[model samples]
Target: MQTGNLLPLVLALAVLAYGLAYMRSRAVAAPLGGIRHLKSLPFYYAARASLWCGLPALIVLALWVAFEGKVIQGLVVSSLPSDLMPESEGQASLILSQISNVAAGKLDPQFVPPEIAQAGSLLENLRNQSQTFKAVLVLLVAVLGAAFAWSRVAPNINARESVETTLRRIFFVCAAVAVLTTVGIVFSVIFETIRFFGMVSFWDFVFGTSWSPQTALRADQVGADGSFGMIPLFTGTLLISAIALLVAVPVGLLSAIYLSEYASKRIRATVKPALELLAGVPTVVYGFFAALTVAPFIRDLAEAIGLEASSQSALAAGLVMGIMIIPFVSSLSDDVINAVPQNLRDGSLAMGATQSETMKNVIFPAALPGIMGGILLAASRAIGETMIVVMAAGLAANLTANPLESVTTVTVQIVTLLVGDQEFDSAKTLAAFALGMMLFVVTLLLNVLALKIVRKYREQYD
Candidate 1:
């Protein structure tokens, strides 16, 4: 049995252990006139038995799978003659790849030296032995854990307490992992950004007006120096996002208000799901629509109106992005409006307020926090959108307020910078991290500002 097959077998063993423990617990409690005499329910005892039968075995299996390849590679490398021993990590990696290919029969032994061929044979044998041992060890641990838990299924034991404690520990570990992972990502980006700043002056990258990042291969080449200015990108990002919010906010909010306050339940039922279907449409499909349909229409319309518009323009991307986020705003706002207390509506109505007045003064005020949250989410969606911008806005990074201009955003630039094989030492590659850090900072500031506004409004409502 291999590690993959052992996983299902371990689960099967856990199920068997649970049944046996459950029956035993019932038997022990039966003489005492029912399960009421047991320290915990039979369910708890069975659950504890299942945990004992599965958790340790899974841990061992995970450890084996994680370390098995590395351990085998180290042994094979160590067994090589001094003349064949790899001098660096790169050489070791190359040797390992060749050995792997040879062992898998993708490369014939005749194509490799005798030492490498021997190492391949050893690698295959060691892997086979490791799999066999791993299966046996995992099964042995599972049976031992099951037997131990089965013996402990007594009336005096608190199986529920033990199971709860284990679950609490698991939850804590999961939360810690999430927090640590976020911290790790932030630190990694910060470190790379610092490295990038060392090579390119912070003032130049931040304040330079030019948006080029193509460094020449030779010093004598034309335009050897690359510009790492981010102003144009950030400007385009905000311009597109502002346009998207303009189109999305009022339309989405108004629709949500009508759906929640005035529309019949049957209409709401028919319309809400259909509106939300926009959110389910794939972004690539939206990209294709924007590229093939919207951009050309905008360009031709602008021309007809005696205005110049790029074939790919900010207006087209923003319009499409706004349409995409309508569902997000509407769905969230409708839920929040409906969640406002019914008493407030009745109170306003009893005071002789009209339906519109009641909505504006009572329900909307009460649901303002949630409504703001929906708007904020929509704004974020617009800011982070890349596919529509790439297809319709063009990747030009022009620092213009005009919606008919060709433009690109920070996200599109970042994707372009990191598209293919890259060395981190180069400013072009590191520039992506710089852009990312700026975007992160701007987003954090937006979130903080939104929260402060929300808090102020919330206090007024309270």
Candidate 2:
């Protein structure tokens, strides 16, 4: 059966199991002068039975779904004649694609060899048979588990313990899955980065000034040698991020202070959510704003001021990105400022300090750690942003600190490297992974620093 269809059926079976076990629990308790005589509640008994009916079936179904394609493909490949067998993984993949295409009627039968046609037929048959067996196995397991749970429903059975243990294990499994997924992503990037390093020297990538990643397909092509220098990309990233932080930090921090410290309840309530709506605006919209409006305006302004500015400049992207991240800083800082002990503020005021004085001397210092954390988080968001940089900050890896000039960020270059039809083995494509690894490292360091600052200051307050 299809997974979607099987899931609903399994859910229905679990519901049935719950009902049956609940009735049995009530019936068993009736003879002992009420449900109080039972070791656990009827709800616990119902939950335990539902879990028993669902978990085993779901586990079997998941495993079967995960491995069925690989198993069937292996079987199909093995059935091919030795002379027709694939010699490499790539060849095997191509054969599988052809078989799949033929099975799906996307390929003409007469266009391929008879052996391939026969293999496609076999593939179809195996898929059908596999689905049928999977359905049967899942149903049987659900029934057996439900039956066992039904039999175990007695006055002395501690269904609560069983249910709690199962839930705890499920939670642990979820945590493990999340951790493993992160590990998998990191290792995948690491391996690809290693491949990239093999093609391009690490020192050249890190320190070289040029940023062109275009490699000629033929030896006769001009400028065939691609430069993988990341210095310019990183410089642009930091330059833009600095401009964004310069705009965001002061404005957001001030707004947060006003809302949390000085504003009345009505004003705070009116302004906070409206300000936070900036965060909900789609980044693409921000990109459009930066590209269509901000970039042109900045160029015109710069020209009026007797300075040159690119039509697409870091200033434009940074300003818009700063505006976008304002809510992040404001909301977080406001909450942190509000979390400072009321007694601290009251004590400061009673000691004849002005509101501003109290805020500076007590509240601001107390909330500094959390506010710094918020700023760092906003900095990370600004650094990692792609759309605004792409649309407004032109993709020129100019190693300049001038915000008025066109420059591209690491993320922008990464996107540029991997956007279209590109071979992964090439340094151009693998450079994306290398950029990703660098970004991950940078963001990790920022987070670690933020955590340390927060912890150190948090201890003082505690």
Candidate 3:
């Protein structure tokens, strides 16, 4: 049976187990004058039965599904003749792909060697057997667990403890999965970054001014040697992010203040959602807007002002990105400003302070740490943005602080480096990981600083 089809069956069986256990628990309690005489309620007994019925079966199904493909593939590879065996991991992967395509009838039998065709046959047969065995095993386990729970559903059994313990374990497992995933990602990037620094000098990547990463694939090609300087990328990133922050911070902060403190309820209700709708706008649409609308306008404006600007400049992307990021800043700041206790405002007003003075001296000061945290988070968002940068800023790694000049960010270069078929061993490909590491470090520092600022100035109130 397919795993998808088997899930509903397991759920139905769990429901049936619950019903049966509930009845048995009631029967045990009825003779004792009510559920009051039982060790736990009938609901707990039923819940325990349902949990045992479903959880073990789901765990089995999960394990089987995770390893089924690899196990079957290994068996099929082993069945191949020794001479037909793959030499390397890549060869093995290619061989498995061919076998899978043939098994699924996506490839013709006559196009491949007899060994692969036979392996395809074995793969299909093993998949069928594996699916049948998995269903039988899962069903058997579910029945056994349900039976055990039913037999234990007596007046003396404290099924509540068992159910709560199981749920606690499940929660712990979920938390562990999230933490392990983050660890895995960091380690993967770290290993690749280490490999990258082996091929390219760390000082060259960090300090060199040239930013070309186009190493020739063959020795005869010109520019086989490439510059790996990252200063240009970082400069463009900062220039664009600075422009974005310059536009976003004042505008968003003021809007948040107006909505939270000054605006009427009706206007605040209407305008807040409208402003936040910008956050929901797809980044690709923002990219198109940056490319088609903003970039051209900036170029023409720069030309009219007797200033040189690229057709795609940092200013265009930064402006559009700032517009995109406004909601992030405004929403967070609005909530934080609103969270300042109403008493603070009343107390300031009672002290003969004007509204603006009250806001500046009391509310804004109270919310300053949260406001700063939100701004830094928005800055991180602007720095990590890729689509707008790619669309409006041309991919010339010119080390310039000029917003009107064409420039690319670290993210754009990372995308360019890993866009298509890439050999990981090459410095060009590995450079993406190195850039990612640097980006991570910068964002981490920003977040840490935000945390420090928040903790240092945080005020607690009843």
lDDT of the candidates, in the order given = 0.93, 0.94, 0.93
Candidate order by lDDT, decreasing, is: 2, 3, 1
Across residues 57-122, which tens digit of lDDT does each residue of candidate 3 receive? 999999999999989988999999999899999899999999999999999989999999999999
| Tens digit of per-residue lDDT, candidate 2, span 59-131 | 9999999999899999999989888899999899999999899888999878988999999999999999998
The estimated TM-scores of all candidates read 0.96, 0.94, 0.94
Candidate 1 at residue 18, lDDT?
99
Our tally of clashes for model 3 stands at 0
Q: Name model 2 segments beyond 4 Å from true.
A: 218-220, 350-352
Alpha carbon deviation, residue 311, candidate 3 (Å): 0.8
Residue 426 deviation, candidate 2, in Å? 1.9
Q: List the residue pairs that clash in candidate 3.
A: none
- The count of residue-pair clashes in candidate 2 stands at 0
How accurate locally is residue 281 in candidate 1, as Cα lDDT from 0 to 100? 98
Best by TM-score: 1
Give the clashing pairs for model 2. Answer: none
